[model samples]
Target: MPATDLVTAELTLTGRITTASNATFLGSIGDVAVVYKPIAGESPLWDFPRGTLALREVAAYQVSQVFGWNVVPHTWLRDGPFGEGMVQLWQEQDPAQSAVNLVATDHVPEVGWKHVLEGQDESGQMVALIHEDTPALRRMAVFDVVVNNADRKGDHILAMTDGHRHGVDHGLTFHRDHKLRSVLWGWLGDALTVEELEGIDRVSEGLNGGLGRDLAELLSAEEIGSLAVRCDRLRLSERFPAPSGEMSAVPWPLF
Candidate 1:
């Protein structure tokens, strides 16, 4: 079925995703499952504009597509039961595979995984946080930087059964300020791969065309301009950036 039909068709709410900070619901249009976040349900944040969270989620998806990364799932803005909202096709994450994890400090993996940070656990014993070092995840990290993602919790990275990594919960993104808080900091200071640079180039070129046109509908002029600035900076540096703000680099709760 066409994506338009699926998004506009009558939706049957199956359940609420209570864990989400903003009100979110699981629904279906015919046989297709989707996650929906209504604009009216968004909680106000000091930094972001009111009622714009749902639009930001859809904007993130558009940026992901512009880069040709497909890091974010298919998402769009539409009217739902609660009013205007963001609707995204639900992706089933792999139950057996965990891409991010906490482990005893002594058992940190020597390869394949990147140890992000070390700290004390509840009992005061040393523990470490680690995440898989893969191209899929690297792409997502790059995507987050371009979008200025503010809440990239570990649980937000969905590891699919086929090994694809999908990033979600991008309601806090594309701010004029640099607000990139994330769990994918394993690539800090690393040189961007050729593929990654190419992706950045694609987005930079589109900022004045299709991508910019789409984003203007959801973001402010300053926000769209800041996004282009981020792409340019990343392209020029050709490396992952280190955190530079007074705010914490990683999100709270981790997952």
Candidate 2:
């Protein structure tokens, strides 16, 4: 669908997403479906400034566009039923496909996936956290690093039937501090491919041009500067970074 169609079309709230920490709704405009999160529905966050979650989501999409990876679905800010908020085109994911999974520790696949960690389930069975080692998902992991995403849970990744991995719920991102909690740690310590570095380069260079100008509307100077720093750091390291800071490397209730 054209970008303007979603932006201009009439937005109607069809259902509430009760599970989201912030107010979220499933909505539609004619035939186009979308996910909506109004700014007023945002809860106060200790680390992040209040009422900016929607903006950060839009910023993540902005960076995704620069990467040309479509890691985040097309997202933007607009006036909705409640007030101004973030709106993103809804993508129906394939139920059978999953980029990340919690599987029996003994049954962990020997190939096609990367092991993250092992822990016990609610029932006391040992399970391993793993994600598919595909280019599509790896691209998302790299994007998460560049954005300094603070939350990268498994449920946030949508596995499309055509092999595309779409990541959602990007409110906790682009912090001036290093709060990169995520479940995509499978590639930790791995050297970045040439293409991956090129993506980072594009974002870093764009910071001086159009992309940077676009982000200025949504982020503070410190946040935008932090974004540039992340890009340069990633490029220099040439590999996935290990978790740093006092924050846990992975999010709670990971899925």
Looking at model 2, report the run of 10 residues with the lowest lDDT sum.
1-10
| lDDT per residue as tens, model 1, 112-149 | 99988999988999999999999999999999999999
| TM of each candidate vs. truth | 0.98, 0.98
For every candidate in turn, the CA RMSD to the true structure comes to 0.8, 0.9
lDDT of 2 by residue, 46-99 (tens): 999999999999999999999989999989999999999999999999999989
Cα-based lDDT at residue 20, candidate 1: 91
lDDT of 2: 0.94
Q: What is the Cα-based TM-score of model 2?
A: 0.98
Angstrom error at residue 88, model 2: 0.2
Question: Residue 92, candidate 1: how far off, in angstroms?
Answer: 0.5
Error of 1 at 200 (Å): 0.4
The true-structure Cα RMSD of candidate 1 reads 0.8
Q: Locate the minimum summed-lDDT window of 10 residues in model 1.
A: 1-10
